[model samples]
Target: MSSSTKPRRGLSALAALAGIIAAGVVLGIAELAGAFFRASATPVIALGSTFIDFTPPWMKDFAIETFGTNDKLALLVGMGITIALLAAVLGIVAFRRWVLGVAGVLLMGAIILASVLTRAGSSLPDALPTIVGTAAGLLALRVLIARLRRTAVGDPAGASTATTAMTAATGGRGATGVTVTEKDDAATGQDGNEREGATAASLPSAGTSRRGFFAAVGVTAVVAAVAAGGGRLLAGARNNIAAVRDSLAFPAPASPAPALPAGVHPPVPGLTPFVTPNDDFYRIDTALSVPQLTADDWVLRVHGMVEEEFELSFRDLLDADLIERHVTLTCVSNPVGGYLAGNAKWLGYPLREVLARARPLDGADMVLSTSSDGFSASTPLPVLQDERDAMLAVAMNGEPLPVEHGFPVRMVVPGLYGYVSATKWVVDLEVTRFADRTAYWTDRGWAEKGPIKTMARVEVPQSFASLEAGTVMIGGTAWSQHRGITKVEVSVDNGDWEEVTLAAEASVDTWRQWSHELSLESGLHTVRSRATDAVDGLQTEERADTVPDGASGWQSVQFTVK
Candidate 1:
């Protein structure tokens, strides 16, 4: 509002900006320190994961639909922006009122601490970084605010006198100011005003404080950048677990899969690949950062409701007799005909054999498997103990499982949706009961038992594709997992359904490829495909949203014939 006050406000604003940078520097240092402990336990990641865990099902679906595989990246970006805005506000508030700023910082620390504590494997030590970082941020805010306060508007009368005295002492102008003071009492008001103005002109200006604040902020920013870069480097160094995975090899399967029969893959263009490649396989999990566990340090513990509790090291798992089989895994969240299903050749020890050793009590009907990162799945004990090829997979598609896909070891149970069966980075299998406990997804409103619904997906003549007006090849893949696909039928424009040529069945646990040909006329056409499973279960034609358990419906695609 006043000419003298404008520069003071500008300086305070700059100081506020400096305070924000200092806060960032403090957090960067905390993250740097945390790299040596547990990298995944950092405040941001822990809080972000907690937020995701509490996210509602519709929002999850919306995110998947909107950002696809980049949904996690989008969430991180949103969190970063939200944090930055709050930090900026805190900085400005601290500059105005230091106590309030400190309270805000502490509140943030409490939130982060609470989030960390609730995490899967977190302990009191995980709160150390956030606590230390908050303290540092509060100190930085106080120091920067103190420095800026020197230029803040104060008692005008006292400030003017202090300024004049400082100028006279520093510039050796005491004589001139003293002489002017000697005449000022008897002089007219105008002359007194003129003398006061002269004194004010000779005093220090606000520009100096502004310049100093900027310099301090610049230095703090550079240091923060260095610390952030160092943290990344340290985290990267811990990623050597990937190299260990590459060098490590699981033992040959004692009961190898049967040899593939000829004509397993249908000779149809645009048909889905019979076996989804490891790299292209769909991954939908709760891991924001992949847990890097070296095989030497990895251990699996089986306990709870078991007559005999046992622990197995990674070496022990590799030494056990293993079996290789092709299994199709599906996500419960996958919509009818979605791409979130993949068939892979898995190599691992049979889950049934391992559970047999544990000897789960009869009362317990579920195995609550948990990942190293804290994600949990409630798998039916009967499904795992049955003659099915449920296993603790060590390798996928002849290679060690990708870190993102779950390295070291993961579970692969056929017939069931991944929400209840495929536990990655698996560490503990607690033989429990469905009545006594629930899993991560189950608590979030998903069904306890997730079975893969029979479905057929069209791979060729995708929705909105333009095809030439002639014989058009309609090809796709159908999957029933435990129940093999018996027949695939295609219907054109609500017309009669016709059976498509089905590929030879490899095993009941994998998907089947099928194709059909159709004579088309120019215009738009809606084509749908459905499959009948070996047990007389037909893929439903009614549409249903993927939730609770799984989706059921015929997958329809519309294309124009040229």
Candidate 2:
């Protein structure tokens, strides 16, 4: 390649690199600044949360189905790639026209600033990190791009001088002093290749500029990494609520859940346990980062459309008469045969009692429960006031609520899908009509009242499994939530359904395990299972997507007998 072309290509690449490096500096500095404020004040977290708030329901369902618990991680990775690509473009543009690059960076900052300031409970101070970070990024970009330009200008001139010195030293002769002619140049394929020789000679001549540019890049990268790592460490130290949670001593419940039956957990391998462990519970929420809140500072305000407004502190909740119940929570986005449902023993005060103290107005039909992170759920007021064990849950199993699940406090209502009922890190309860306000998911085209559908799944003899040819045991768990699963029936390859033995029921609100032993011949076979609820409601056989409400359809798995 010609010396001019080589320098141009290198400069372009360096410019792109400068842009990427500048973006890293921006994020690192922003994160460092955010350490002084709330975690949501960080530009990436704020932007990611905003994106989640505006995402369509279908898209949200797709993400949960595609990535399960790692949806947030996937989103962050996707955002990082997108930002890097855009930054690279901005860098190239800045190299050619500096003003446009500045405009692009400023525009991104504006977007981030808006995301930070518009967050729930956000103040003007929350935008400081974004503002400061953007300024630092701009400065970094300016300095790096300036260095790249200098290199571009210096490389060609240095190459020309080096070529001239080399020609004069060689006296137009080969390295061994052999005479060179146009015919020899043509024969050796060196004809019209003076620029190539100049390009080769430019390597040492341009070493200073290359070294300077690379040194700046290296330093910037190191600083960015240090800033980012230090910021994360600082944030973790500041928001280490885990220590506080672990130190908490929860009072005994006024009413406790009944002792589990002997056969509640059937001796079936691969079947979901009757009580999902705290760590094994399914988590499907919009929180990018778990909100860190201490029990001492937590306060819940109950107001709006009420005869009396009341504020409940964490201490007050702990002192109140709490009840424990084994409740199964389901995500509306859980696909058929999906594992987005879990049962756990929850302990907390009754929501009905809490709302009773406030005396919600007669016309109020919804209770808009909002999280500390600004996510809100519009639940039916009647559901919270009903005879069900719906409560302001504070502890799961025997321990304080896990931070990710919702430390300090969260709502737990049986039967209803989590989107409409469970509001983790709950801070505000506004009683109002559903017509007056829409929740985060409801605004995104999901059903405002998300009641979980009765569904059954086949766990053992998994899909496409090869099994021994004798009597094979088929087992799984089925749930109808508030309406207990009374029977589970299994059918083989479109054959007549046979009743499966149901394990002892834990409660009307928890799922039941079921297993059936059937003799099967060799070859492929599809097993389908369906459940009947206590109210004689049968699990639907028609397939429907998990939109508007929970999914429906009997789950079927195919296996082969060896």
Candidate 3:
């Protein structure tokens, strides 16, 4: 705090900064290495349907169309490179410098906090081990510095070398009786007669410098440990979430796929489309990989704007009445018409049941649903209450929800497009009005209430299609999502609509896939599909893209009658 002390303090600060930079660079390298390991694994193509079953249909569509299950490999590799570059920059900036070093450490910590450090649910508790390790390093550094200062710079024997030389030089009345040469005397050494060390002894400044260096390093370690520890704890505490992920293993052959009504052919060959095999569903989301969380650790908080704050446990939801309903989910990002939607049986407690415990006030219009991983969707409470089967589903197709699918619990609303309905890995349900909040997607320029638009696809080749004049099955899927797909019509290019045989309607929640047999003549042909919903809304033929709202139009497929 004094004038003379300013230089030393500045130097110490510089040394401290260098230490932090060094530590952060080391940590960055470790994280980048982890990224490399992830990149080397085989890309997960279909995360299995169970993992994707409950994801907001819109989110699922986006991942497939944008990242594509396999292209995700590139993103992992790119993030690794970025992290490594950041580390290199930090290392350079920290080269015996303080401000730069501290800055680098802070940057590295932020990257880790926002991305890498949050690998699994409840990241806060698991980060304790890191705190313990960094703390131990600082403690050791401090104690080592104190001991080194005393032994290396403060040793008396080490400091006495100059005193002996001085006594022999000024021998005018020396106790040992050694005569001093006129040319060598400390008293008159100014003109080559006296030596500076002989009279005014001094220790090597190098030793002092080394001692200070160590002391600064020790201080740096202590500060870094505190900073990192505090950050980890704060972040972990703020985002504490756990979702149980059950395994959806391949089914035994005997459990033949669910029987479909007379006409529909499943999307995949050889199996019925209604019963999505657990192993064959699509998975896409921000989580490049799934985090496996345990049931005992899972907690669902229902605490905002509620008369009674209900903290629901996995056991509580599962113990209530179990309902099984089949539903189709679609992603908003699916192309003007895309393949990112699917149908599957989901099992769980009705969402209305959970909200009941919270006892929402009369004004509560929206339930802002959130995940353990910082994603949210504002589902209108009115929708859930009106649809009795809408649930916080835990099981998909008769098995515990798979980890990739939000695992322990997820929201399931029929009729609504995924944008406002399906929220996977759900952790919170803030009972509030629409005016009170905006969800993650809403902030990103999407319509607040993204209802699924009517859509239909053509499956088989008909007349003029170069098919051998024989019976051919023409089938495809149509979805109004929550609104119930009613009539599906197939037509030959610009031909009249012919009613196709429809699959049994599982419920308003499930998609109604339909099929019809067509007799074709040998030639090139164009087939198209269109759907009429229960609300009398017809699938539009206009070309409108997915923007602030969902996509719509007829689905056309070209083929030849061989």
Each candidate's number of clashing pairs is 0, 0, 19
Question: Which stretches of candidate 1 lie above 4 Å from their native place?
Answer: 1-20, 139-212, 268-270
Query: For model 3, what is the C-alpha lDDT against the true structure?
Result: 0.58
RMSD of each: 6.1, 7.4, 13.7
Per-candidate TM equals: 0.86, 0.91, 0.62
lDDT of each: 0.80, 0.87, 0.58
Cα displacement (angstroms), candidate 1, residue 362, comes to: 2.5
lDDT of 1 by residue, 378-419 (tens): 999999999999999999999998888888899999999998
Clashing pairs in 1: none
Cα lDDT of model 1 overall? 0.80
Model 3 clash tally, residue pairs: 19
Candidate 2 wrong stretches, greater than 4 Å: 1-6, 157-204
TM-score of 1: 0.86
- State model 2's lDDT: 0.87
Tell me, by TM-score, which candidate is best: 2
**How large an RMSD does model 3 have?**
13.7
Candidate 2 lDDT tens digits, 370-441: 999999999999999999999999999999999999998999998899999999999999999998999988
Candidate 2 steric clashes: 0
